[model samples]
Target: MAKTQYYTATSIDGYIADANNSLDWLFEVDEGTANPFGEFFAGVGAFAMGATTYEWVLENDNLLEEPQNWHDMYGEVPCWVFTHRDLPPVPDANVFMISGDVRRVHEAMLVAAQGKNVWLAGGGDLVAQFAQQGLLDEIILGIAPAVLGEGTPLLRHKLHVDELILTGVREVGQFAYLTYAVGDVARMGRHLAAETATLLPVNF
Candidate 1:
């Protein structure tokens, strides 16, 4: 079955980017001979990203001056960028700028993905919305050896330990890769509701 996955790198301190919103620290890490991202991305027929992530890639990769970079990385896979503002598109790339509910976009992504999995290329907050909606199924994190005192978080939402099942763990150079299978949304909702009920004050 096709699963919705959030695959991204993070610092040891659980930040994706530094205070400056820069990923320069990530590139400084020693990547082993084998990069597993290509393999993971192969199964992704469609992907979505928040405006910040999209803009970062666009500017950092110089996708405007060199649109081929986008092709080389993602190929012809459709990308939906969640942004309310007007952002320039990469030439010759299947990029869509959209806003509003993630549920509708998720449906479109599923249809576009066909039998393939959907990837959530995120900026934390965006992925949290998907998780809240029960659209996110898996989380793959490449934990790098770095600590940013304050920066963009890995995920904006609070996920209980019981909600995640560790499926795989591997070490690649200085990075530790961890794969987690998220619990179903329905069950998660029930758990959250139960917790909320416990927190409610009882009448004297």
Candidate 2:
């Protein structure tokens, strides 16, 4: 079955980007020869990203000038970018710019993905939006051996311990990779309600 997954790298302190919204620190990490992103991307037939992430890629990779780079990386796979402002698209790349209602966009992504998984390439806020709607299925985090005092978090929303099951763990060079299976939101809500009831005062 195709699942919605968030795969991204973060600092040791759980920051995806620095206070300046820069990922230069991540690029400095030595991935060695065990990087798993290739394998992960192969299973992703379609992907989505926030405006910030898309802009970063555009700037760093020079997608506007050298559009072939985008093609070389993703081939014909479709990509949906969530943005409120007008942003230039990469020539010849399968990119869709849209905004509002992640649920609706998620449905489109599922269809575009065919039988493969959908990747949520994101800024923390964007991923949180999907999580809040119970649209996220899994989280794969690559923790780099660095820390940023303040910056963009891995996820802006709260994920209770009971809502995540650790499925895998591995070390790749200076990075620690962790995979988690997201639990059903309805079950988690019920658990929270029960816990809250128990904590309430019982007055005669």
Candidate 3:
């Protein structure tokens, strides 16, 4: 089975990008620490992102024209971009454009994933949508030291997360990378119920 994961940085206030949909605040960190993120990306089999994130990369020409060292690390993994409007394809065949209902896009992603990890390269709203639908398996957050007064939050609206176990924490200079394994709600509920039963007072 393929695992769906969300990997993003957030402000101390839990915002992913600024009000203008800019991630300038996150860039303030010393770029040296970004190697770990590249390593994390290398482990993934494929990539998936919302239309806005795809456009942002294209407009700015941020993504490298050719596969970088990180891309080599991951081999020729596929990347699917979910968009509402039509857009030209990337130079590399590895990158594909997808437009349709989000669920259908997800199904296509899973097929493209093919037992490998699927990265949900988010721009906030899209991530929130998948998170709300309970499609997310893990959330890998690179918590920056800086704070943003206002921006797009990583999570919006109410979500019932049964539990999030901290798998690992790494301190990269001033920033910290946190890995969390978000468990299934039903399994967590059962464990919580058992614990509650043990803690409750027994009247015989």
Best of the two (2, 3) by TM-score = 2
Q: List the candidate 3 regions with Cα displacement exceeding 4 Å.
A: 31-34, 62-75, 161-163, 183-204
Q: Please list the Cα RMSD from the true structure of every candidate, rounded to 1 decimal place.
A: 7.3, 6.4, 4.2
Across 1-204, the per-residue lDDT of candidate 3 in tens digits comes to 567888888887888878898877777876453587667776677777778787766655534554353245445778777777887665555777776566777777787777777788887777767766777777888888777888778866454545565667987766777876664734565687799999999999
lDDT winner between candidates 1 and 2: 1
Predict model 3's lDDT versus the native.
Answer: 0.72
Expressed as tens digits, the lDDT of each residue in 1-204 for candidate 1 is 899999999998999999999999999999799879998998999999999999999999999999999999999999999998999999999999999999999999999999999999898999999989978899999999998899999999888877787778999999999998886843565677799999999999
Off by over 4 Å in 2: 185-204
Per-candidate TM-score against the hidden true structure = 0.90, 0.90, 0.77
Best-to-worst lDDT order:
1, 2, 3
Worst 10 residues of 2 by lDDT: 183-192
Give the range of the ten consecutive residues with the poorest summed lDDT in model 1.
183-192
RMSD of 1: 7.3
